[model samples]
Target: MRDLYQRLRITPEAEAAEIAAAIERCQHTALKADAATVLQAEWRRAEYDALHDTLSDIGRLRARLGLTHAPYWRAGPADDFSLPPGPPGSRFEEWMQRLNRAARAHNRWRRLRLGWWLATLWLATLAGGVALGHFVLP
Candidate 1:
């Protein structure tokens, strides 16, 4: 599979249809049946297996985290679960809830980071254009 990926110049993130298209393009371009092709075949198989495993793991983790329930998993307030009070000052459940909250915070931070990058790029481009216009108009 590694060989195939190289011949097609594709990554694991490429969709199956994209990979197939890439292979077809490579075939039309006269790629050879060689060791590279063998490696690419292996890589593609591994990528698919890895994706499947990761998705499975995420599903299991969500279930364990009680995210499968409505409120936490969905946008509606009706689906939310109230935190269960732990027995007699034991902080186990509270600690777990804190960890979950932290994870969500981290995820939100990542999303905001991406948004900021995009907004900055856009503003820079707009400012550049305004400066260019000023120069041209004068």
Candidate 2:
């Protein structure tokens, strides 16, 4: 996703007036109109910010996982090309193995963290229900 704030040359936290000023100063009339339309509304700006943040997070995750190449759909079949045979103890192979191991470890940690949060949320909901039953039912 395009970074609207960067395009407009304004910070994400910029006020409406600041955004309007930046939009007016934009050289491209189409971009200026688009920015004004999106940024002029409170709710649209909030939605754009959320979408931008999520896309940025995904980008960071991809970089961390060494997935800087085009996505799977853009990349051709896996069997299209094969790696050249290397020595038994090649440094590249060793580095790749280590990277795979680290990626697996990171994935496991993320799953564990997500599970913990889900469990906590479930418990909180259960406790709230019990409290409501105890106090409001009687």
- Which structure among the candidates has the greatest lDDT? 2
User: Which candidate tops TM-score?
Assistant: 2
> TM-score, each model?
0.32, 0.49
Compose the digit string of candidate 2's lDDT tens values, residues 1-138. 456687777888999899989988999887788888789998999898888777766655544444444446333332122223444565655778999999999999999999999999999999999999999988
Q: Write the per-residue lDDT of candidate 1 for residues 35-116, one digit (tens) a residue.
A: 2343347674676457545655655555444445454545433222223233443554566789999999999999999999
What's the lDDT for candidate 1? Answer: 0.58
Candidate 1 stretches with Cα past 4 Å from truth are: 1-91
Give model 2's clash tally.
Answer: 0
